[model samples]
Structure formats: structure tokens, C-alpha cells
Target: MPTSPSDTLQRFYTAFSQLDHATMAECYAPEAEFDDEAFSLRGRDQVAGMWRMLCSATRKSGAAHWKLEFRDLHADGLQGRAHWEAHYTFSATGRRVHNIIDAEFTFNEAGLILRHRDRFSFWRWSRQALGLPGLLLGWSPSLKRQVRSTAANNLRKFLALPPA
Candidate 1:
């Protein structure tokens, strides 16, 4: 039987809470797309790689600590939405972060996710992650673009690294 949207998301979140990128990747289709305040990614490889890069970085840092929570999940046919929160240390500045996000998803015919978009406040996030600078310019389009550029660059660098 095909997976229900709620079940697929539940599985995804379960893996996320454990920082299990492989399992998270399993929730997406080969051509899946993902986007958020930081950056956008297309194809399963890029999307999955993002999670792997993040989880691996945090784990290797030895200072990694985080939590994920999801609620208000709703699904209709191939679409789903959920309210989630992420609590973690911002790797760049070693700042504690509590990010609240709303996620929308679209599923492929095989019951795998084809698109995943997370919406959150860059201003709120910047204040926590970038501190003074974010407080002053978090709402600036330039600042937001810079953040997205940096994140994409970082992901590219991570993707370029050879397999362990």
C-alpha cells in the first residue's frame, strides 16, 4: 500500500528528530525539490545532500544539540502541511536558535514527497543567528539574499567533498 501523506511526513520528522538524513532522504522522490528561508534546492540529490550536510556537520562538531517538534499536521490527497519547530545552535555563531516553521509538501504518485517548502521569519531567525547585524538588517532584501547565497555556497562545498 502507498504511504499516507501524514505517515510520510511523520517518518520524515522522526528521522529528522534523530538527525537521520538517510531516512529523511527516503521520504523524497528522485526529482524532489526543497526550499526554505535559507536556500532552495532541486532534485533529490541536492535536497538529500542538504540534510546530510547539515546533520553530518552538526554531529562532527561535537557541540551539536537540537530538537524538532511537529504538530497541526493536515494532508489532502497529494498535499500536506505541518507546523514545526527547530531548536539548535547556529553553527556559524554558536548562538542558540529556536526556529518556528510552517511546511507545505506535495507527494509524487508513488507516495514520496516531490516538493517541500518551509516558511519562517528571516528577521526573527537573523536576530538569533546573526545577533546585532541581523537585528539591524534582517529585513533587508540584500541581507536575505546574502544569507541564501552563503548557504548555497556552503552546500556546494559540502557536496564537492568526497564520500567518507
Candidate 2:
């Protein structure tokens, strides 16, 4: 039987909480799209790779530095929404960050996520992740674009790597 949209979202976030990128990947349709403050991506491989990279970093930071909570889930038809929070050490700056995000999702007929978007405050995130520079330029469009570019490059490099 096909999964419900709510169940798919729940499984995705639950897998994320456990740092299980493989399970997270399973939640996406093969042509899925994802967007967030730092990155915008198309295709499940890219989206899943982003999750894998993040989960790997969180795992390396140790369990003490990583936490995830999700709630307020709602689904109607093929659409769903949820609120979540993530606490993790930013790998780039070794700074602690607590990010609150609201996510919207559209599901395919098979109940996999076809499109997922996460909204969060870039200014708040930058202040925590980038320290002084973030405090000064977090609200700037250029800074946001730069962050997206850097993240895309990082993901590209990661995708080029041979699988473990």
C-alpha cells in the first residue's frame, strides 16, 4: 500500500533525527526538488546528497552536538507542512547553531516527496554559524548567494567522491 503524505514526512524527519540519510533519501521521489536558506537543488540525488553530507557532519560532531525535533505536522491531499528545529555544530566554524525551520512538501502519487522547501531566518542562522561576518552581512543578498554557491560547490565535490 502507498504511504500517506503525513507518514512520509514523519518518516523523513524521524530518519533525520537519527542521522539516517539512507532512510531520508528513501522519502524523496527520484526527481524531487528541495530549497532552503543555504541551498536550492533539483533531483533526488542532489537532495539526498545534501542530507548525506549534513548527516555525516552531524555524526562526526558526536551525538552531544546534534539534536532534532519536529512537530505540528499537517497534511491535506498531496501537500504537507511541518515545523522542526535542529541543533548542531556548524562544521565550517565549529560554532553551535539552533535553527528553527518550517517545511512544506508536495508528494507524488507514490507518496514520496516531490518538492520540499524549508524556510528559516538567514540572519539568525548566519549570526550563529558565521560569527562576525554573518552578523554584518547575513541580511545581504550577496552573502546569501555566496552561501548558496559555496554549498552547491561542496555538494558537487561530495557527489564526485567514490562511494564508501
Candidate 3:
């Protein structure tokens, strides 16, 4: 049986909390597009790759733990939204980061996520993730561009690595 949008979201969150990238990827359609403040991805491969990179980054950090919390999920027709947060320590800074995100999703007829966009305050995130530099320049557009560039570079590097 096909999953409903809410069911798909629940599965996505469950998979994510368990660092199950494969299951998380299955929540999306092949042509899915996902965008956040730092990374923008098109297609399932890129989106799934992002999750792999992030989940692995967290695991490798050792000093940080990742937690996922979500509530108020609602779906009607082909759209859905969720309020979620990722609580972890920023790898580089080792500072605690509580990223509050509002996710908007569009589902295909089969209820696969076709598009997922996450909105959050970059300045707020930067302050927690980058510390002093983030506090000083997190609000700058240039900072946002730099962060995006770094994210894209990280994604490329991750994609280039041989599968384990």
C-alpha cells in the first residue's frame, strides 16, 4: 500500500533519527528537489547524498550527537509542512547548535516527496555553529554565499569518495 504524506514524513523522521540514509532517501521522488540555507540539491541522488554527508559528518565528529524532533505535521492534497529541529554540536566549532527549521514539502501522486524546502535563520544558526565569526558576520549576504559555497564543495567531495 502507498504511504500517506504524514506516514511518509514519520518514516523519514524515524529513518533520520536512526541515521538510516537509505530509508530516508526512499521518502523522496526521483526528481525531488531540496533546498536549505546552506545546500541546494536537485534530484534524489543529490538529496540523498546530502543526508549521507550530514549523517556521516555527525557520526565522525564523535564529540557531537544528532537529535531530531518534529511536530505539527499536516498534509492536504499534495502539500505538507512540518516543524523540526536538529540539535547537535557544530563539528568545526564544537559549539551546540539547535537549528529550528520549518519544512515545506510537495508530494507526488504516489505520495513521494517531490520537493522539500527548509527555512531557518542563517544568522541564528551561524552564531551557534561558527561562534564569533558567525556572530559578527552571520547576517551578511556574503557570509551566506560563502556558507553555500562550502556546502557545495563538501557535497562534491563527499560524492567523489569511493563507496564503503
lDDT string, candidate 2, 89-149, tens digits: 9998899999999999999998899999999999999999999999999999999999999
Which lDDT tens digits does candidate 1 get at residues 1-164?
57888889999988988999999999999999999999799999999999998888667653356888888888789999999998888888888889999999999777799999999999999999899999999999999999999999999998999966
- Superposition-based RMSD of candidate 3 using all C-alpha atoms, in angstroms: 1.3
The prediction achieving the highest lDDT against the true structure is 2
Off by over 4 Å in 1: 62-64
Better TM-score candidate (2, 3): 2
Compared with the true structure, all predictions reach lDDT values of 0.90, 0.93, 0.90
Which ten contiguous residues of candidate 3 have the minimum total lDDT? 57-66
Cα RMSD of all models vs. native, in order, equals: 1.3, 0.9, 1.3
Q: Would you list the clashing residue pairs of candidate 3? A: none
Number of the top TM-score candidate: 2
Q: What's the lDDT for candidate 3?
A: 0.90
lDDT pick, better of 1 and 2: 2
lDDT of 1: 0.90
